[model samples]
Structure formats: C-alpha cells, structure tokens
Target: MNKLIAWIVFLSLALGGCATKVSTSFDRQADFSRYKTFCWLQGCEFTFTGPSYMNDSAVVNNLKNAIIKEMAEKGFTYDDQSPDLLLDFHVTVENRQTNVYRFEEDRFLQLDPIDQSDVYYFLEGTLIMDIADRETGQMIWRSSASRYLELNPEMTERNLRKGIGIVLKKFPPKER
Candidate 1:
C-alpha cells in the first residue's frame, strides 16, 4: 500500500510540476474600445471548480494576494457586497483509473494495494463575467486563463495566480 501510494504521489508530482516558463502578453491585450467605463455590481459571487485550489498549507495567502493585486491593477475593484462583474472559476481534476495484474499458481494477482490507482490531471481557470441587460442575462465581456498545475503544494498557488493573471489580461478586449 505504502509503495503504491508513494508511486502514485511520485507520478502526480512528476506530471504536475510547476510551470517555470513565463509569457507577458496580459497588458498588451487589455484594451477596451467598444466599451470603456465599467463597474461591478454590488453583490456578485466568486467561485472555482473542484480540485482547482491548493490545500491551506502555507502558500494560499501568496496565491490569493497575487490575484488581488493583479485584478486591482487592471481596474477591477474589490466588492464583496456588490459587483458589476462576477468572478467565477472552473476547474477539473481527472484521476482516471489504471491497473495492472498478474497471474500465478492459477490465481490472479493485483497490481498493488492501491489496485485502482489513477493518473491525476487537473485544469484551473477563472471568468470575469457580466450579465447583459436582456436575453436571459447573457454574458457581456469575459477574460479567462487556465493551465495544468503541479502536485507540489508550494508550487500550486503561484502557478494558479500566474495563470489567472495571464488569462484576465485580455479583459475589456482590444482590437487584435
């Protein structure tokens, strides 16, 4: 069991390694022509998809802080009571099952204690959404970003924030 668990962790860590590479295109695309002045409603909601967050294991503060900083610089104000734009996040963690078995002495052998181990994969992204005046409160404008995260708790927050920042940089939309 221990070995199997360890291997699972190892593989997850290997595949979920931090994203060291960086790209700085957020600002270049954050320009608005069709619409300029903006405001968030007074009572909007913020949320994320499952498996999109790191455990509260020390790096959460840094990750949250980075998001707040970048959003502010982009002219997005923080309003818990009211917000014109609703910030929502969607994430998915896939742990598809995989197994191996052997037969010996007319009996079958299981792969490991963790027989149904799986390959873990995840994606995290956020949407800055606004509801249109009519047409079922449709979307007005949105900015988003997403990326695979590393298994390391220490690396998760930073990578997630960076991903979010890059995605949101295109908010307000510019002619490209």
Candidate 2:
C-alpha cells in the first residue's frame, strides 16, 4: 500500500512538471488599441528550427490557424495588403533527457536493496509569437509557450492550439 501511494505521488509530480509554460512581454508605451488589422510579416511567417520531422506543414498550418483564431477573438482582422501590425512566429524543438533512480527492496533480505537508474529522452518544443508595428518596424508584443513534444499528429495539434491560446491570452494588454 505504501509503495502504491509513493508511485502515485511520483507519477503526479512527473506529469505536472510536463505542463505547458508560457511567458509574455510587451511595450507598455505602445498603443495596443491602434492595432486593428494584422498580417504576417514578410519572410517571417513560419520560422522553424528543429529536426525535419518537426517541420511538417500540417503543424505549421495548425499553428497559423490557432494564431488567427486568437487574433480574431481579440477583434483583430487579417489584412495582407496594408496592416497595422506585422505578425511573426517561430518554432524550435530541442532534445532533452531526464534521469530517474528507482530503488527496490529485496524480497528475501530487507537489509539489502537494489538501485536502478534510467535516462529518458524527449523533445522540448517552444513557440514564439511576435507582433510588431508596421510603420515603426519595432516589436510591440511577444509571447512564448514551451512544453514537451508529442510525436502523435493529433496530440501535436492539440498541444499547439493549447499553447497558442495560453500565450495569446494576454494579447491587447489592458490599458493601465
């Protein structure tokens, strides 16, 4: 019973640590209200840095759709010809490993124990979104969301949507 409880606690901690993390920063002086329409920045729509598998078109489209949805929710329209704000996004994936040690009690001898160590490897992905003023060409707002990568296509799409939602939640920062 004690071992079962310990395992449950360990699993909870491990999974909780893998949750998505998001951070954002913006120019407080910038007039966010003036930004009405937005379009992808020239040569900066899809910036990716990672393995070939991580650069799939499906993933890119998923990200683009998610961003568009978020912007629309904020009453922003898409205007490619002449936009008030330029949008850019970047995706990066990196290898990461975690080491875990497991100890087991010897059934026959309680005094002796067995120690087992294991190293688990995974991919960590980060999504960065940048919003810049079209006329000034200066960044106005930026946000990034990071989490462990999943190989499954469905899971990947879900993660991207969730990450984008969380990062863009602070968009059009409340006037202070």
Q: Write the per-residue lDDT of candidate 2 for residues 1-176, one digit (tens) a residue.
A: 33553455456756986788888999999999888999888743545544577567877677677777788988999887888999887777777776554445444134232354455677777878889999999999999988876544353556667777888888989998
Give each model a TM-score.
0.45, 0.80
Best by TM-score: 2
Error of 1 at 172 (Å): 2.2
Report the C-alpha lDDT of model 1 over 1-176, residue by residue, as the tens digit: 55455565556665564443322232343223423222233234333334534434444455455666666877766555434444443334444333332223223244233344344444332323232212224355444433444334244556656655675665555566
Worst 10 residues of 1 by lDDT: 127-136
lDDT of 1 at 107: 30
- Candidate 1, lDDT over the whole model: 0.44
Count backbone clashes in candidate 1: 10
Cα error, candidate 1, residue 126 (Å): 9.0
lDDT of each: 0.44, 0.75
Superposed model 2: Cα runs more than 4 Å off: 1-13, 43-51, 106-115, 151-158
Task: Identify the candidate with maximal lDDT.
Answer: 2
